[model samples]
Structure formats: C-alpha cells, structure tokens
Target: MNQSFPKAEKLKSKKHIERLFAEGKSISKFPLRLVYLKTGLPEETRIQAAVSASKRNFKKAVDRNRIKRLLREAYRLNKYRITEETDASYAFMILYLGREIPEYEKIDHKMKQLLALFLEKETGKKI
Candidate 1:
C-alpha cells in the first residue's frame, strides 16, 4: 500500500465527523488521544483520519498547526498497522493533549503504540 495520505483517506465530511464524535470510542496514550468509529465502506478506503489540537491548550494558530502537523505525520508513517481484515471502515480523530511542544520521536513512538491499541480495540483481536 502507498504510504502517502491522500484526500480520499481524510475525514472531511461534517456529518461523518459529527457522528464520530457523538458515537466513537476513545483511547488515550499520554499526549495522544484517538476517537474512532467503524462503518461500512469500500475495502480500499477503509480508514479516514483527522488530527486536532485544542485552542485552549495552544493559543496561537501556529502552535496548534504545528502540533497537528506532527500528529498527522506520525499517523501517516504508522497507519499501515491498521490494515487488518474487517467488515467495517473506520473514521478517526487524533487529538494532541500535550502541555508543551514535543519531539517528533516521542510522538512517533507513542503513535505506533496508539495504532496497535486502536486495532486491538476495534477488532477485539490481537494484532
């Protein structure tokens, strides 16, 4: 599979996002929190993802943007772990919950663990 995160893999629909927030299950690994919901979609496009940073934590747009960027990059690099056989597609929103700026290595490490946990939670089977 391609490593790039294309637009088709993005969670942009307002209705879908609202449903995700309303009904999704969440798992947090320190600085990162993932809210995810599963629905029926094509196999090739089984996952749609979004990243968020709270305005209350980071007052400046630049700060929020930076955190989101890092979160997206980490997820992009490690998202392949989510490619298990399943009957439903997943929509995910990753929230950065750090009080201060974090290193990319830290985020990457945590993101890998987070993705594994997500797979386990969603599938009810170990990956």
Candidate 2:
C-alpha cells in the first residue's frame, strides 16, 4: 500500500470539475465540500482539491496560491483512505469554503475528517 496520492490520481480539468458539480452529489462539512460523481473507469478514482482566498477575501494571488497549496497537501495525505474503501470509480472535487486561510495542521485535520465523512456517506463504512 503506497499511501501516497500521486499526480495520476488527481483530477485536473476544469470541465471535469464542472461536470461533477452539475451532475454529481454534494456533501458539505464546513470549510470542506465534497462533490463526487461516478466515473466509467474500472475502479479507478481521481480527486481535485482547491481553496479560495482571492479578491473575495485576500487581494493577492500569492495568498490564494498558498491556501490552495495547503488544501492540496492535506488532501494528498488522506486520499489513500478513500481509494481503499470504494470499488466504484469516482471523480471528486474538494472545495474550501472559508473566509480565512488556515494553518497546515488545521487544514490537515479537517481534510481527514471530511474524507472520513465522505467515505461513511458513500459506503456506510468508517475508514
């Protein structure tokens, strides 16, 4: 078990994220929102994660990028749990909906909790 989320496992397209939001089911556990949809792939999954702290909150792109980086790092650490529990292929988009950027530790904690919630909701199993 690698327990690592590689680039190949990441969802990369804006179009794909848009489609997931349009047709997929959504669950929000504050600060983290999960948008997921079934995919045609044979038991393969992909994830895309983002954080927003742009002009809406911070006026600097640097601030936005830093927040996004934290969110991505958090997701990358915990995605293995999701991959192990689900047999159905899925495309997931995780959005951060917070007014302020958080520390890495805080974001990581929330990521794990959110992923666990998503797994429980989707599979009825606690991982």
What lDDT score is found at residue 13 in candidate 1?
91
| RMSD (CA, angstroms), candidate 1 | 1.4
Query: Cα lDDT of all candidates, in order?
Result: 0.88, 0.75
User: Model 1 reaches what TM-score against the true structure?
Assistant: 0.92
Local accuracy of candidate 1 as per-residue lDDT tens digits, 1-127 = 5689999999999999999999999999999999998877677898999999999889999999998899999999888778644557899999999889889999999998898888788777776
Candidate 2: give the clashing pairs: none
Report residue 104 deviation for candidate 1 (angstroms).
0.5
TM-score of each: 0.92, 0.83
**Alpha-carbon RMSD of each model:** 1.4, 2.3
The ten-residue window of minimal lDDT in model 2 covers: 42-51
lDDT of 2 by residue, 1-127 (tens): 5566666677777887778879999887777787888877544444444444446776678877888888777877787887678767788777777778778988888889888988998899986
